[model samples]
Target chain A: MIQKKICMLGGFAVGKTSLVRRFVSNVFSDQYQTTIGVTVEKKCVTVASQEIMMVLWDLYGEDEFQHVRDLYLRGSSGYIVVMDGTRKDTLQTALALQQTAANTVGPVPFVSIINKADMRSEWEIDEHVIEQLRDRSWTVLFGSAKLGQGVDELFLNLATQMVQRPPLSNTHP
Target chain B: MSSDSGRSLPNSPTSEGFTSREEDWTQLRTLLLAPEQTQLDELRERLDHRMVHSQEVSQVLPEAIAIRGVGDQQLSNALTPYVENGFIAAVRKSPRAIVDAIAPIMGPAIRQAIARALQSMTQSLNRSLDESLSIRGLRWRLEAWRTGRPFAEVVLVHTLRYRVEQVFLIHRETGLLLHHVATDAAVVQDQHVISGMLTAIQDYVRDSFGASPDQTLDQVEVGEWTVWIEQGSQAYLACVIRGTPPASLREDVHDALAHIHALHANALADFAGDATPFKATQPYLESCLLAHYERPPKQGALKGWILIGLIVLGVVWWGWMAYQAQSRWSHLLDRLREEPGIVITQARSMWGDYHIEGLRDPLAKAPTALVIEAGLNPATVKMEWAPFYALDAPLVLARAQSILRPPESVQFHIEGGILVATGSASPDWAREAKRLAVLVPGISQYRDDGLVTASISALLDRINRTVIHFPSGSSTVEPSERVALDTVAAILRELDQLVSQSSQRVHLEVLGWTDATGPPARNLQLSQERAEAVVAVLREKRLDKAATVVLGSVRPLDQGGSNQESANQRVATLRATLTAQGQDSQTADP
Candidate 1:
């Protein structure tokens, strides 16, 4: 069995915890997020017939007043960056957090998710930005924590990438 | 270069031909640096072959290790695993060789351990046995019952010094549980989560307090439990202890953590989520699960002694009471045996009770009364007395007394079956006793010889004291003489009544005396006539228990010089005596 440490990073209220909670209910309560700025959840997924346990470190949403701690990204094998499609500012926050995670944990596997896809009619972020991110070789996908859409794929795609790609550095910083 | 040096260089471009100049220059270069080059080549070869370098490393390894060990613990930390693995392999390959190698050292240690164990076991056994029945133990049992805990647990709670209930060896980086060991009664939870929580809490404290990473949360106390955490390079050991843990306990935890890291260095360093390799670290974690209980107080033994003292006192008191009861029972049996009219056929004591079977005369002493007299409970003794006649003197006397129903004035006893009646009794009672004594079962005859009849003597005295006086020449009855004659007649009647009950009779005599002034023949005839006159008067009154006697001039009634004496001599005196009924009254007169 292989275990991968996955960090969930996003702007405040981007449904990062909501995405984890919708995918698997095995998560600490939201109160831990307020106190420790991180709540860990675990999910086991089979990628290429190999059972990979992904230990998810759901970090508190980054905002203007609070920034995600670099210490939490020490051992991340992969990460997921979430943004709210209704708020363009949240999309910018997700992009900035992705740079921080990449710099901290090195260029490992990651996926950018535009959450709240169920409210696509009210979405402010256009598909052109997601198309540009895909052209930059970044995996970008649409997800909705409310409708439970694309949450499983969002986690499993990262898990498959982590399992197939050999880490360039040690597992832990 | 000098000209001489130039001549020694054969490959110089000027000396040699142009074609061989390059080769000559090469030769000249080799000739100049050959020795130095050879030294450098040898040094490079020595560096290239690792075996020769290893030989040199081996020469300095032990000294380096010793020096590094003296400087710090890193050398020991690096070598502990190798030593442990080597030892384990050696023991696994030939346990006997290892055992034989350490025999001299292990033998005494094993004997000492066994001896100490035996001593400890014996002491504990003695203590438990002593306290099992003591008052303190009873109180502990009561506490156990009240609190719904085991008695041993209650005792342990009171005597506990310190107990490490659980030990957790957790990964420092991921906060995942590597291995865990706990005491038998400890409550185990999700060790992974617990380990994570412990790490998070420690991190929280560190982050909250702005403490350095080296400064860890070593201990966390909650109520009676203290979680002692010892940080290692790779993993940390956390033990939950109940009670005041000694200072050495921290050292032990530290040592256990260090030993686990030493033994499982790679496993801990490369730990992801698989904890299987860390399972072998259970013994090290288990070694941290220590418990110490103090010996119970000597007060338990003291309570046992007090209980023993009370028991001894109770037994002594019981024994004394039993002895007293036995003594009384024996005394009662002895008295029963000594009793005359009671014949003991069987007597025995069973279960602190007595049963006696005997033949007793109706007149014998009652056995129940004897039991009360012996100061014993009457209910404790059962008596069966059969009726029988006893020829013992007392019973015979009692029988006679019962049958004869003699008066209080008479005392009857049996002497050889002859019922003897002593003490004076009325003639009527005496006569009745004579009749009934012969009828008694043990009496052959009745003896009243010692018995005096009071009524017969009274009558004889009255009859003898009576007298009558006659005038000198008168032979007739006068009024005074008639009164005297009447008293004599009544006396004679009483005497006859007293003598009528037995084969006896009363005889009365009347004697007449004359004065000495007349002729003898005339006086004799007067005396005779006087006596006849008295008799004739008594006979006229029908008093037949009488005989007449005359004293004439041949006998003087009185020798007085006065004429009154003469008048007194003319009296007739009455005498009464007891004689056989057919005896002649005239011949018996005196």
Candidate 2:
């Protein structure tokens, strides 16, 4: 049994916490509950027929007042950068946190989950912006934590990346 | 020469104005004077932010509050609400996680409280047993028998019955407590830990035996206390019980779990550490704590009243029977009085039996036999009798006459079975006669003897003699002779049998005589004349034709008075015999 430490990073109200809650308990809430610091939860999933225990650290949302702490990003095996599909500026914030994680530790496996896909009619991130990130060989998933659509697939894709990638190449921040 | 002593002066362009130490200081000054300096600029920028971002401050706030309030009452009071809010928020995030951290302290507290409760219950049960066979226990036993329950179960209930201490509803998959409730005396300090422990035990059982996921731990006995669990589809119910509970309590647990699933299945499926929605199932879970009792009967029951009634009826029946026997005896006596020749002089009763004592005729019926015939106990009837011949009036009269030898003048007879007598007799004879008559057979009663005194017929019947004598030679009646003649006339006047109705059939005979001293012819003539004079006086006294005066020859006696009275010879003795006509009256007096 391999326990992989993972983190969820995104801007404020970008469905990072909702995404973890949906993947762990298969539940969604319309009411937004603000998280402080970090809350750690655990769930067991199988990737490539190997049982992996995913220890998820749900960090506080990054806004103008509170940004992601680099200490919380230490010792993480992989991470999922979440962005709200209704806002284009939240995608910029996810990209900045991705670069910070690469510099602070080293580049590990990661995914970008464009969350709130249930509100596709209100999506603000253009298709051209998504095509540019895809050309960089970065994996991306569009999903909704509220509707529980593609939420579990998004977590499983990240778990698969941690399993196939080269091991112990970066420093444990 | 000064340069040789200290080769300090540098051969730079402005060496005279700026030495090496002086040049280093001038460059630091130059750097300080620049518009944008890297190190100093960064220090000012870091200090400018005044802790407006609370990430670093928030990390130390809780620890600061705890250290400040360590020995200060006011500070602790001020921070109490915030601490409670923080704890609640932590619990809402992960209930199972919080319970796992604090289980060591909470577990001992719950176990000790339940131990105290069970100890007190056992002590009270022992006290009641020492107090004697309690009415409460006995009544419960009877009720248990009626309701088809076991005796030991009923006894336990009346003595120290089990109570439902606490109830909890838990999520089966996550082992998080959904809802919880407890009695006032319950000691469930932490409900989340108990729920987690119960789920852990269930999982242990299932995994150890490779059982199905639906398998659950139904009952767990910890000393005198028991924990009952019931598994549902999404969640399960657990109950903590103290003392002995009946076997039927499992049904209550099952019902509560079913209702919780029915009401909140959708909420639990989406439970993201928010247990508020499951609070609606609190009442349903609490209702699973089941307790039942039976009331004891009041006073004595219907069987006691029935026994008393039977005793009263028995006494009344015996009394009625005794009264009936006495009445039967009285009726028998009345019937005996009506029978002929059955003379009952005395009859009495004692103690519901009869005592009959009196005269009874030889021909009368036996009283004992009649009592037996009347369907009574003969031993209860006592009879005594004095025998007699008869008690009729005529028979009693004849018996009295034969027994008493009264004088001829006295008479005896009977009236209404009473003896009566009449006439006169001596006093001595009358008393002796009455005494003897009373004892005579068939003489039931004795009356008075009528005997008269001084009777003339009684005197005359005894006397039968008469006398007549004449003086010498007198033809007329002498003075003494006149009374003698008068008596002769009276005797002829009375006495009907002496003066016969059939021509002087009654008779009185008389003779005449004279003395010797005269010539025969003259003496004879004088005697004849005297006799004629007696006859002539009788004739003057009106003698009937049947009365007779006889004249006969004279007779003489020896001479004594000399020849002086030769007329003595002429005195005639005349005797008259009055007899019936034409009849010889030889011996008429008897």
Candidate 3:
């Protein structure tokens, strides 16, 4: 079994862990539990009829307090950069962390999940940002782990990308 | 030197001329001869003064001759080197005079050197404190160790800790806080205010004393907060930190500034106070969140001991709980052994679960129920015993009572395999007792003939009105009405289940009514269909199996000019009544 490493990078409380748990366990909780321990989870996904085991690293949220360690992204196949749909500032943090991860591990495949899609009333991320990301050939999705919506498709597509994309060069700063 | 003499001759011949040709010759000759005679006398007197004064008077004479515009450049040039040489000779003879002359300037310089030496001594002495966890502190300790400076400095360096609370990327020229990321908030005051103040202060420092352009405020410590400022040509990154941060954070600030400059050089260089492009440096700014720390080596040792202590305590507590459980179980075993004609086959307790099996005498009361009195739940203690033929009616009743465990509201007696239960019970308890009675060994029949339900007449007489309502003419249940219908269905199920266990069988009569708005036949049909719809919903919920759904026809529920009354009339109602036995009602309640 080929085990691929992936990272869930985002700002604080943006449902990165929630989305991963929902994908791995098919369960979601309403509690806003910040992920402080248990960095990664392993789940086997069958992509293209081949079982690919995914090791997902739920990196520390990039907020005013803590930043994701670049050591956590070494030799990874890909990552999912998450942003809270309700906070517009977190988008900048997500984009910046994405750039750093690219610099650290070279550019692997990545997608953006604008989480809390169920909270349409409190949404703050503009559609133009999503459109801009889409224009850059980036896969953008809207999801709500609470409602068990779009969480599986996002991870499954990433799994497929991990299998299909060519391996990146080993040398990364 | 020559021009004046030539001009004097012209003046003598033209302006002050001689009068007669022979007399003019005599006057000119006398004038020229007289000026020569005056020069001859002055030279003779100066020669006598030079002879008396020696070379000193001659050197003074050149100086006097070198007075402004009195003599030409050549004459002044001759005296310049002479005066300069004389001054040098005098300074060489007594240099102390020059030194004393600049006493005011040298006074501060000498004192400053002494002060600097003293400050260095004090810094080395004071930095020998037992605690200071800064990069400077690290170097201090290293210096103390490598050079054998002091032990206290080593200790001091081991104690300091610092964290970068926030980093702000500000335009150097405009001082706009373009982007900021912090562990805490960036600034208590407005970021713009702080940035503007920083610019004002920087500008003031630059302009105030005409200090060197290279001079810039490097570190600003305000109480526990330290702002390490790293200025670039285009921008600066000010790290708001606490404690003394490491040198790496400064390097990080420098690297981040350089990276920002490289990326947005044009934007920062020509920044119009627009923060949009500067936001591109947000990622690099977050690198300032890195913190440097140094804790005492004893902390790890202390933590180890605490962990060991906790583990020891946990083991003790666990062993104590196990000991208590064992003693209690052994006491229980002792009591069981003391019982008459009882043989203990197997009895032990492990992991808080007790298992006991023995041959119990029929006459001795089973102590299984007594296990609960010992602060233990009897259900957790598994007890099994073989039956013996020492049976009696009272024993049979006891067995049935133990198995059924009827509520205090209920009472019952057993005769042979037939059990008669009576008293008052809520519909659920009554149903539970009825079901539980059959499970008692040797009991074939069960009865609750004497049980009187609590105010059953009140329940039957009252009609559950407006429990469910249909939209104006629709037969479908609205989403909001399902909650009320769910409650209604629960009550019906309990009623049906209770009646099934009782001697009297009861079922709900679900009726739907419609207001008189159409022809009587149509209203009747509409009302009938609505009732059927309500019945179908109830059946779908599986609330009751016994329900006699009837169409309670069109009643004029409202006067002309009111929609509320009409809506109220378009509703479902339920009435509970004793169902006929063996009627095989089409609506069977569960």
Candidate 4:
């Protein structure tokens, strides 16, 4: 089985932990993120007939007071940036965290998720912003953790990308 | 050198004329120094070909390393990080493979290390014990006070009072379980979750305190369980213990963690939730699953023997008491059965007391007194004796003597079922004894062969012999005959009193006889009057228990030949008799 470490990075209260909860059958509680700045969950996803064990590291949401620790992002094969659709500034935070994840783990595969898609009417993120993320050849998907929409696809897409990509070279020392 | 030569070659003119000359020059060069050029070409080819270059370097690398190693430490210093990193990477890739490859080498070294560690631990333990009351002890006490640990806990730690119940080898980076080993009796939860939580807690402590990454939370205690975590470069071992662990136990745990890290470095580094690779660490982890329970403090030999002696003494005392009670009960029962006039029917011991129920003659000895004689408490003996009359000879004779109230001169004895009397008693007593001897239960008969009556026999003889004279052909007594009749009446009264004292009655008979001086009818009438007159006088003297008989000329008192003799026959006589009260009388004549 192929194993990949996937970090979930995003802004504060952007439903990053909820999205991981919606994706993986986890034994650890969400309070781990609040306490330790990271919570790890594992799920076996078969991508294109290959069993890929994706170990998801859901990092505590970064805010003014706390920043995502680089220690948690070490050895990540890919990452996902979660943005709350109701908060446009969360999109900027997600983009900024995506940059930090890239610098920390070095050019791994990543996907952008605009969460709360079920509340489309309340979405503050515009199509242009989504378009700009797409223009960078970055994969941007819409999902809602509460509604369990696109949750499977969000994690599976990252797992498949990690499996198709080259093996990680920038792992922890 | 390759970079310098490549730069020179590029600058060496790559035009068409230069290219043709280059080939011509190469041919000319090959022809002039063919063997040398062949050697040069081979050299160039070996440098150009990756495989050939690798083979060439492989051939020389050993010698070069050997030479450089002997010359200085520079080669080793330069290669150390790469070798270390490569080793780390290899272990990370497949720890099992690395362990398998190095097992032949690591086995003895690990054993030696373990032996050394064990020896060290033993020495430390001995030292701790030796220093328990010395200066080190005072220091330990001070440490306990400073560390806010109980003195007992400190002592237990020194005494090695703990068992390593479980060991968890966890991935350092991902917080995943690498492997777990536990004692058989340990309660195990999901090791994966526990590993993650342990990592999270460590991370939380570190992050919360802003401690350096190198600093780690080493120990966690909850109730009686303590988790001691030893951090290594790639992985950390967490030992779960059930008591205050000894300092050497932590040291041993640290050694085990270090061994596991050295052995499974690559596997831990590359561990991605596939903990199966870490199974090779089982022996190491299990080794860390050590236990050092403080043995009960050794007791002095004298003290132990004293304890056993006391217990034995108690048991022996109890057994002796029981035996004594049982023996006393048996002896008491035997005595009771042997006692005369006592019949033992039931005997048993109940509730620490001897209960005896039997039939006992009232005159028999009390069983409780026998209980005392047997050296047992009377209160501990219960006796239920139903009164019975015994046929034993002594008891029967006693009964007879008690009932008859014989005089001192008379002694009663029993032979078999017969009550015999010896010596003389009053006739009243003798007669009364004859009647009442049958009342004693054991006496079936009464014998008085040797017994004599005291008074009543002589009195009877005097009364029977007395005679009263009457005048011829008259039914009256003279004054002298009356006096004689009064004396006989007094004798009769004495006999009646004696007989009355016994269960007997007395009777008297009076007879009148006539001489040949009157006709037969007149004589009979005269005799009848004389007897009636005698009886009438005796009746006046209170002798009413009498009867009259007249023998008028039919039978005279005497058969004499003269009238004077016949005149003596014309008399009133008295006869006396005695009989048992319910029987007919027997005559007594003198």
Residue-wise C-alpha lDDT for candidate 2, range B107-202, written one tens digit per residue:
986897798578667855664563235545577768888989876555645554677878888766546667888866566664554664566566
How high is the TM-score of chain B in model 3?
Answer: 0.26
**lDDT agreement with native, every candidate:** 0.76, 0.67, 0.69, 0.76
Structural similarity to truth (TM-score) of each candidate: 0.45, 0.26, 0.24, 0.47
Better structure of 1 and 3 per lDDT: 1
CAPRI docking class of candidate 1: incorrect
Using lDDT as the measure, which candidate wins?
Answer: 1
* Model 4 per-residue lDDT tens digits across residues B1-590: 43443344444455987778767666765576678657878889877889977877999999999987655435765787899999999999999998899999889879977886787588557756754665447887898999998765676566666878899987787666778988655789866657766777787788778899999898999988999999888888899998887788878888888888788767776554456788788778878877775543446545766888999999999999999888888888888878888998999997587788889998777677788899998887788889999877777777777777776657788777888889766676788888988887888888999986657667667777877777666676788887887777656655654565466776666777778765677776777777778777877876665322223223443434488777777877667667675454666665
Inter-residue clash pairs, candidate 1: none
Better of 2 and 3 by DockQ: 2
* Winner of 3 and 4 under TM-score: 4
Report per-candidate DockQ. Answer: 0.06, 0.01, 0.00, 0.09
The CAPRI class of candidate 4 is: incorrect
RMSD of each: 17.1, 27.4, 43.3, 19.0
Name the top TM-score candidate.
Answer: 4
Model 2 DockQ reads: 0.01
The residue ranges of model 3 lying beyond 4 angstroms of the native Cα positions read B1-590
